[model samples]
Target: MSQLQAEYIKRILSARVYDVSIESRLHAAPLLSRRLSNTVLLKREDEQQVFSFKCRGAFNRIYKLLQENPVSGVVAASAGNHAQGVALAARELGIQAVIVMPQTTPGIKVEAVRAFGAEAILHGDDFDTALAHALALGEERGFPFIHPFDDPDTIAGQGTVGVELCRQHPEPMDVVFVPVGGGGLAAGISVYLKYLRPEVRIVGVEPIDAASMHDSLKADQRVVLPQVGLFADGVAVKQVGAHCFEVCRQYLDEVILVSVDEMSAAIKDIFNETRTLTEPAGALAVAGMKRYVKERKVSGQTLIAVTSGANINFDRLRHVAERVEVGESREALLAVTIPERPGSFLAFCQALGKRAITEFNYRYADSGTAHVFAGVELPGGSDERDALVQGLTDKGYPVLDMSHNDTAKLHLRHMIGGPARVPSERLYRFAFPERPGALLRFLSAMGQSWNITLFHYRNHGAAYGRVLVGMSVPEGDEAKLDEFIAKLGFTGHEETDNEAYSLFLR
Candidate 1:
């Protein structure tokens, strides 16, 4: 082994985390085990005092900093779990701490940091912006900056999780799946496991939208993601750390990318097993493990996944529940064109034949054909969806499968009740502050001139409420609509040109 690897092992072994950190439990996931046809274990770091494993690394780093010399205070920038980690660690160590979080961060996280006895400051729109502002403040205040996941001490501190894993699981582990964001936790655990149990494979899981580690590994170097999905906010890091990337490249067997739907289903799975709702990042390992098992067709092997944290807000459950069925292949969405004549709807219903229709929307497109959007629950999986599609095709009904259409899933599904009544329909998506009376603010601006033909907005527990608005604005009145939108001052753009709108609405 290289000298660097040896040093990491030493740091992990001698980590001074016992003062404030507990060895999180490794528990059986009976539901997941039965479903996957293998023994499944979950490292329950969500059971930590802060409901996250981040405290281990934060405390270890803080403890060492105190041992080295006297320090004024520590400052860190984070949108979620890490902020809580530093705050709790600083409180236990009797050191002052300042945590900077993004202005867009959910209210629960910011309040939790302050409750932990740290000074919480909300600034900027996202974590990167908050991080830059925090560094500047740290420099001006002469307080040391505690990086969320980039530093050596932080990575080594997190390595202790692997120590506990090795002690808990003496039996052969086929694979240990870990979630990767900025790569600190994955590096810390994988390197240690590679040293302690060379036979075990380490797989890193990341959301496809925020696959910084996966992209970096593919390029054989660190790469910054241009944009990341905010649904999985805990792992929405744009880039990986330098040292963390090096260690991961050396130790990680492979990195798997999962979708938002898969992560949602994993959240449901973990909830069913442990009665705990984990954040998207926390459930990533379970999601990845399932995908790996299915793709490789591997079975009868013991698999372990780290349930990293449960800092998710309660309101996000609706979104998770909505996507879980599709992610698990238990639901299929379809677009069908049938005759506009009477009794055609009845014929379609008879053809459906009691498959339990989850959702249905229909609107007259013309005198000849009517367009319908429908979702069906499939207990028998993708084969059922295929068979139904073939049956419909054989019956001379034109069908378009929409299960994989993101535009249809995220926005169009809610807007499915057909086209606008008036001529010249234009649709726009708007993002408004998610405060009480926010929708009222938009409506008050719209006035009574244009008829709202289509509107889809359901609260999804986000800082911004997404609204799909279809307005019947007559030609030559476009400038007025533009003027109104500009004066409204909300962030939005026209979705009229989107193909989904043309297919379903126009």
Candidate 2:
């Protein structure tokens, strides 16, 4: 073993998280195990006091700070779970703590941090912005700025989770799936497992839209994501931490990217197994594990997935329920254009034949053909969705697969209106990590300068969400659009030329 690996194991062994955090149980999911024909185990970190395993690292780092020397206080910025961890840890350690959060953070999270006795300061519109404010405040107040991840002490603390898993299971793991956001949890678990249980394969899971670690590994260096999806908000860091990235690059066997639909399905699976619902990020391990198992087609092995956190809003469950069917190859979305005449609808329905229709929306177009956005429950296996699309196309109908279209899912399905002759309308789609006031932040960015022509927003029960905003931009002010979007600190694109937008709302 490397000398650095030895030190990491030592730190994990000496981690004092028991003072504030509990040893989360390794729970067996019999249903899941049977379904997959493998021993599926869930590391129930969501059962922690803060409903997240972050408390372990937070307490460990603060406990070390206490041992090293005298400290004034601690400060951190988080939109969710980490803030609660730092707040409670600080209170337990008899030290003052300050937490900075984005202005758009949910009220529940803000209240949770305040309840733990931290001075919660709301700042900026996103995590990156809030972190900047926290660092500045820490420097000004002469307090130690506690990072949510990245610090050596914090990573060591997180490694204790791996230690507990090995102690609880007492068997060699075939593969372990860990969520990768800033990469702290995966790095910690990877290092510890590599040192003690080298037989165990450690794989990292990332949301496809917010895959900083996956991108970094592909690049052989850390790479910053231009934007992160909010569907799995718990692990939505735009850039993997420097230390966390280095450790993961060395220890992780591979990384898996999961889609929002897969995450929704995983949430349902976890709920079915344990009668407990996990947030999108919390269920990522299960989603990725299932995908990995399907691709590898290896059965009768031990697979472990960390159920990271469950700070999901109640309203988000509906969105999950909406997408779960499609995510598991149980459903698909398609835009089918048929002739605009009587009996044409009946002909389309007869062609689909017994395949369940989950959703269908159509509006009259003053043209020869009419477009219908349809969602249908599909049959089993991966190729079925493709075959269905192909079958529809072969039936003398022009079909556009809308299973992965942002415009189709978020707006076109609901707003299937006839085209309007707006002279200067421009459409843009923006994606941001979802919190309490995410829409408000977008509106703030919009300001009162432009006339709003049309708008659509939907929450897909993931850490990230998207908005389609239509504005009337004058010819002379077109140059300002790029600058405005760049300054928003989130990812967005112009969809004025999108066929759906042009056909329906433009």
Candidate 3:
């Protein structure tokens, strides 16, 4: 082992964590075991003080620093968990601490630091901005800056998680999954594990959209990301720390990137399995474990996934709940363009068969053309969904499948359908060929007598098409409408009173 690795292990073992910190429960997860075909153990570090394993490192690092310097206080910059860690630790140690945070940080987190008795200073808009301010404060006040992840002391302090993991499980763990942000957690745990138990493989998980560690390891050096996704706020670091990178390069067996969808799904899984609502970063280890088992084919081995923390924002849960179906492949969004004809709408509905309509939106203008947005619940298999799309395309409709469109899945569909004010209005849906002059034919048949009220549509990469049209008419014009729609011979539905339409597309 290198001298630094040896020293890290020594520091971890010699650290003075409270007796309560030494023993976290290691419980088997049957749900994960079934999915991965391996015995999966969860290290419940989310139950720790500050609801994160960060406290362990912060406590140890501050104690070690104070023991050495004695007189100087500590300062740190963080948006959430790290700030809580330093504040709680400093308060426990009777040391003055200042936590610099971004002005954009949520109110809950700002109050958390204050509750821990740390002087919380709101600085700039992001972590880097806060860090810059903290650095200036540290220099001006002659206080030691406590880096969240970079320093040797912090890395060694985090190694204590590995120590506890080893002590808690008697059976040999074939693999250990750790979340990577700035690579501190991965570096510390992997170094300690590789030294003490060389047989165990260490895998680091990162959010796909904010994968600084994965990119760094791929480039064979530390590289900074131009932008980071904030969904997993705790692990949305733009760059991996230099010291942490060195340790990670030597000890980490592999780095895996999980999509925001996967992390959200894992968050739901954690809640279901342990009744714990972990933040996206906290669920990363479990998500990585699932990916590792599939990619590495370690089906029979005992695996451990670190459940790092549970400080999730309550408002974010609604977003997670909305996308969980998409993440699990249970929902699909499709854009279809159909002939702006009467019978065309009915034909499309018949093609959809019995699938539940989660969303339906459409727009018609320029007299002839129309665009439609539709979402459907999928049956069991990818094959089934593909067949459904193929069937729709075969009927001369241009269809665009967005079952995996991240943007649409995250924001668009939920806001597409709602109430509108158009009395004597009848709503009809149709599928048409996305071609020049398709709408002209339908509008020519409907004529200028009927007043069109609402129209909305977009292309989603489909050959065939779908659209929704709202028409306002005189109360006694129902018979005239039936004759007008019958002349077009397009597949469609008079959805004016359809309960589904009223609820989601009124």
lDDT of each: 0.85, 0.83, 0.79
Tens digit per residue, CA lDDT, model 3, 355-438? 655556654433454556776667564566788889988887788988888877767764654565556778887776755445
Worst 10 residues of 1 by lDDT: 452-461
Cα-based TM-score, every candidate: 0.82, 0.79, 0.81
Q: Which ranges of candidate 2 are over 4 A from the true structure?
A: 418-506
| lDDT of candidate 1 over 72-137, digit per residue (tens) | 689999878899999999988888999999876767788899999999999987678889999999
Candidate with top lDDT is 1
Candidate 3 deviant stretches above 4 angstroms: 19-22, 296-298, 339-350, 363-370, 379-381, 414-423, 426-474, 477-506
How many clashes in each structure? 0, 9, 38
RMSD of each: 11.1, 13.4, 8.1
Give the alpha carbon lDDT tens digit for every residue of 77-130 in model 2: 887788999998999999999999887676777888999989999998777888
Sort the predicted structures by TM-score, highest score first.
1, 3, 2
Quote model 3's TM-score.
0.81
